[model samples]
Target: MTDLPLHELAIERHIAAPVSHVYKIWMERLPEWWAPKPWTTEVVEMDARPGGRSAMNMVSPDGEVSPVEGVFLEIAPEQRIVFTDAFRAGWIPHPPFMTGIFAFAPDGEGTAYRAAARHWDEATMQSHSEMGFEAGWGAVADQFKALCEETWVAR
Candidate 1:
């Protein structure tokens, strides 16, 4: 096995909701919690199966749109999801950026949700850290909590 990057950015939150519920929202209600206030998410193409396509656009308050296109490397419903920006649908090569893992596990009666971003090198990792990984992810987590807490099991 090859060595991984020396830098990583991760954030975990104990969401006051079941893992199943959290996963449901993650898949279906992503646009609801995927972005913080003043920004919104729009899924252009998403298929959660392995090797499936996942693409989304983040619209900023100033009307700027940024798209993230990737392939689903792995998905275990209510457990975890891994996706990489290195490849698009059909396994086509794209500019490698980050491989992210979103994991959800049972935490008491709630869910222990973690988001991990792996970089290919130290430079990339440092770039992400300097790009407000903590604040951005923190805002996203809070938004997720609000969405799940409000919707509960209404899916």
Candidate 2:
């Protein structure tokens, strides 16, 4: 079994868009500019309700596909979202299990978005951190913010 430790990684950024618009971009149109490294997600199923399933197939650059399935623990439109990786669609708990929380708040003329990912344990956190979690997520967040801003302007 993979080691499970308690750990947290929080990233916050100010997106130049209204909270509602930013949230829509995140949940409704994420596939657009989600990542530039050739990763795509086909949301197999999404209920967006507590105890409901949210599953997606992530296609890698090399044409390999992997499924990332989880459950939505909480969701507040334009405000917050929480999900857990404790149970996948068809698999049991695996290594580095995590719970992710995303929060959005009004910041001046924009939205302050924060994402906190809590892993099962310190070892798992260390492993993910070493695997470039900061850089990878940072890049995605940057891209997301840019897209949101562009969309906001076009609106």
Candidate 3:
């Protein structure tokens, strides 16, 4: 393994719900509010287990569809999830992007959800950061929280 840049990015948001509830929404109904605008998740398959397959089709504003497929590296139900964009369904190496880890922790009557991405190089990290990752992701998180709250209350 070569020496990568090792970029770490994290965002924490308080969702108006319990950890289990929030986690369920994330895993089951992620496409509801995953992307603030044009993007959306079409979960081709989600096994929620180590070595399980996961794929999502993301549509851009201009109607360009980018299919991101990967595998679950780790999964701690209602606590944490670790996934990588290493291989797609065809068992081919997909675009070399960073790994993602999403964690949910109990907060007073709510849940503290954290989304983090680990990049392999400084350039990659900087490029993503410069592309408004913080703002875009923040918006998505807000949307996610709202969706979760709504779903929980409706249940």
Candidate with top lDDT is 1
TM-score of each: 0.94, 0.87, 0.88
Model 2 lDDT per residue over 89-112, tens place: 444554436888989999999999
The CA lDDT at 93 in model 1 is 97
* Winner on TM-score (1 vs 3): 1
Model 3 misses residue 51 by how many Å? 0.9
**Runs in model 1 lying further than 4 Å from the true structure:** 1-6, 153-155
Model 3 Cα lDDT, one tens digit per residue, 1-155: 97655697778899989999999889888787777676766677887888888887877877888776788889999999999887664456877778899999999999999999888788888888998889988888888989889988898
lDDT of 3: 0.84
TM-score of 2: 0.87
**Local error of candidate 3 at 16, Å?**
1.3
Better of 1 and 3 by lDDT: 1
Error of 1 at 130 (Å): 0.7
lDDT of 2: 0.81
Q: How many pairs of residues in model 2 come into backbone collision?
A: 4
Model 3 is weakest, by summed lDDT over 10 consecutive residues, at 87-96
- The better-scoring model by TM-score among 2 and 3 is 3
TM-score result, candidate 3: 0.88
Q: Tell me model 1's lDDT, rounded to 2 decimals.
A: 0.90
